[model samples]
Target chain A: MTAAPRPAPVAIDDPADPRLAPYTAMRERDLVGRAGRFIVEGEVTLRVMLSARARFGLESVLLAPERLAGLAEALARLPGDVPVYTATKPVMSAITGFPIHRGVLGVGLRGTEAPGAPLPGLPPALAPALVVGLVGLTNHDNVGGLFRNAAAFGADAVLLDAGTCDPLYRKAIRVSAGAALIVPFRQLADADAILAFAARHALEPLALSPGGGETLAALLPPARTLLLLGSEGPGLPPDLMERLRTVRIPMAPEFDSLNVATAGAIALHHLSRSA
Target chain B: MTAAPRPAPVAIDDPADPRLAPYTAMRERDLVGRAGRFIVEGEVTLRVMLSARARFGLESVLLAPERLAGLAEALARLPGDVPVYTATKPVMSAITGFPIHRGVLGVGLRGTEAPGAPLPGLPPALAPALVVGLVGLTNHDNVGGLFRNAAAFGADAVLLDAGTCDPLYRKAIRVSAGAALIVPFRQLADADAILAFAARHALEPLALSPGGGETLAALLPPARTLLLLGSEGPGLPPDLMERLRTVRIPMAPEFDSLNVATAGAIALHHLSRSA
Candidate 1:
């Protein structure tokens, strides 16, 4: 395939320049809304963002000169209109309000057509699939980790309920190894909506709980299935569990539970491969 | 079991009381050193420390009055010689130099008979077991999460090379859901010793790597197996991987890698159960 023409690097000298708004004091700004745009940091995550052009719109990029050479190939794939800014280490740090150790950053727009919609639909190859639905998962690390596990196990998609943290949160993106950029995911209004979606698609919705109906090892994943998880403390809500089948990962009685992310990994591995 | 006589709670009003040394500026002190002792925070971890009476000696405990009732059972198990300090929330926070929302804390001594030795050996029920050996794993969260996973899957023990962080770090203990206290683990001076010990126990040593010799899903775990892991970035040192059988969890090519702890969880699940 012919490479898309690369955009020349635009020099950014001023930290307060309007063009650098998206990258300004990113950690604090991340707490506020980002509209439809999100900051993608690190060379690895930037490449993932650029590659999944259909899922994420490459709005712009700010990079230290040295990082350009390493990302040269991925840069070539960027659309000509996408602006690429280069700055020295100090200047880049000033722009981002933190040391840009990896020296690469990009602004990406979610693929959802409208505000609050789910991500781009899954590909046909993932038609008959296993998906993970997350409910009330506010921890960014866990959100990123579950995406990484979902990607590793070849799960079709991740469905996030309203209470889940943004997958594009800077720390989450880095922790997911950029799987949050590559994986198909959509944020639903609530846990019930995710269950409804699962039903409409002929997928069996399985909620994970410590007191689940069947041990994970003993159950067979249906042709199309959605494994649901909740935050560790409260776990899946009783009402939600009552509406769907529940599965538990057998554990030693002495321990209370595994980290939510670890539990997701084990269950994903079991359903995606073993079952 | 008959309850042992309970120690009367000593009231400590001053955070600077010398008796509160172990709880003083705990986060900072944790970095400097705690001699052979470590801070065990949260009620659950305190319970584990008390239950592990033989492995961990309770030096003293500082608790908020409200937490006393919840911990009464575990507290009863503590020896009469162990000091139990009761304090108000403000006094407790002052002593720890942080908010003590869990309102329970204990200081536990490492059980190794000598410096730099392995942890207490595994119990007989864990014979013919699956274990995890870690090298260069310095992240406290990952270390703790691995212990949690090991506990969930009933892995016999965790062995850490000297480069690995102490699993008893307060954050690690909390993150492990107290598994760090219950799970048997020991620090070896280097990778060579860990490999040697696995051999002495007739365990088939398998190092995990992205470029492993075999896919984890394709392998059958031996009667006794030791899964070796390295830090996420550098992964296992090449020489170490060269010396042992290596395995990789199959994943989508587009994604980078899973969190080291998540990777460990998947591998441990595969070895201990699926295989």
Candidate 2:
């Protein structure tokens, strides 16, 4: 990979400038399809966007000039055509309209792939795969956290259903510490589709349930494993859990609560290494 | 212990009623000491507040009439003089000032115990104890999540330094799924004091860090252990970490991030079992 020329910085004084429109419409971007574009918030995620391993193609960056000196090296990594726009604090606030990400934001293009496209091919020679699957995970924080865990524990990939929120959601990216940008994930129609995808990929499925027949400590990750997690209250569907090998994390009986992400982390750590 | 007679339900139509003062003072109660009282929001926490195991005293309950029928059995457990005030949806919203917890709130008295009082006695004959120690964990969400994990994994108690926030902070309690009330926790002067208390309690101190001398996967839970965790960026003070046995959670190549609460959860799960 070759480094692109550092794009010259441009100054924008008006919040009403059309060039700053993408940075301004964070919430609406989620509602309306982002026209092949996605948003990156905060310096951490911004740096991830500038990294060579980032899946999306960065389109441009909007920054509060104060961050420029600190991000000089990262900014040098921007593609030649990707413009760097600077706005003073007041104008930047008007453009972003929120006190978040500390005046650093990057816009990237998803290319032809939708947020829930087919899985990317695994890194070369990668075997003994371990992955995470999610169903009905609507909460953004949980989704972000799961991705963060997936990255931390070296999961090969993540699989999600339509019921799950997009991991690219800004709040989730922040909560994930930008791991959402690095982890490879695919979204399917729903639980059935996610299971089918796992089966087709030669990964054995394991559903996590509080009523599971086995405890997590007693189970070991299969050669190619896909661990399925559901949102906190109503876990994976009953029949689905019945069909798949199931395991439960032992809890203090009366306090049988664990955040979906926390549960996923413990499971991932247990299965992170080859069994 | 005998049950106190169930308190009579009172109807209050106005938001300005003096009896509703405590409910209206949510934020202020935190800034100014709450005078031996703490608030519990949502039905789950209210139920916990009503539980026989609750450490605090239930002073009164305020509910939207719609929630009354559903909570009847729990109310039967309320003490004799505790008032159950019912307000219409409009009055409820006016009194609460925020649309959270779905119209259910219970005010409980901390009694003579401050939010950070000394530890309660351990259950009789309970041996091989495990606890979580926190330093500079001020984020309510992280603090709440840690408490939730501690409860789920059967952690005997939680110890916090002066830099930490109170677990009873309403937001923290909600995030903990009300486990903040169920689990025993105490606050100390600072990190040094937390270590001092651990020494007094016979809990061998171990700190968690990504740069630790040992990895969690290779470590075993000692008979009695106190696992220490710090906020994300700065982590535990280097000097302190250098002083204690430090362990790390192994991660993928460059993605080294894990949410503090998530980190605490993983460490607690690993050390939860007897070795």
Instruction: Give each prediction's DockQ, rounded to 2 decimals.
Output: 0.69, 0.87
Compose the digit string of candidate 1's lDDT tens values, residues B210-238.
88999887888877888999999999999
Best by DockQ: 2
Clash pairs, model 2 backbone: none
* Candidate 2 CAPRI grade: high
User: Chain A of candidate 2 scores what in TM-score?
Assistant: 0.93
Top candidate when judged by lDDT against the true structure: 2
Give the per-residue lDDT of model 1 (tens digit) for A85-203.
98888998988788778788889886456764543544333366788899999999899989888887788789999899999898898888788887788888999899888867777
lDDT by residue (tens digit), candidate 2, B1-275? 97766756899998899998888857767666576777888988999888987778787899988899999998888877889999977787788776544778888886565564457744323378888999998799999999999888889889899899989888888899888988888878899998988887788898998888888978977878889999887999999987999999888878888888888888888788662
RMSD of 1: 3.7
* Superposition TM-score, candidate 1 onto the true structure: 0.86
Cα lDDT tens digits, model 2, A1-275, are: 96656757999998899988888856766667577778887888998888987888788898889999999998887778889999887888777675554878888787676555557744333378887899999999999999989989888788899999989888887788888888888877998987887767788888887888888877767888889999888888898887889988888878989999999998898888553
TM-score of every prediction relative to native: 0.86, 0.93
Choose the strongest candidate by TM-score: 2
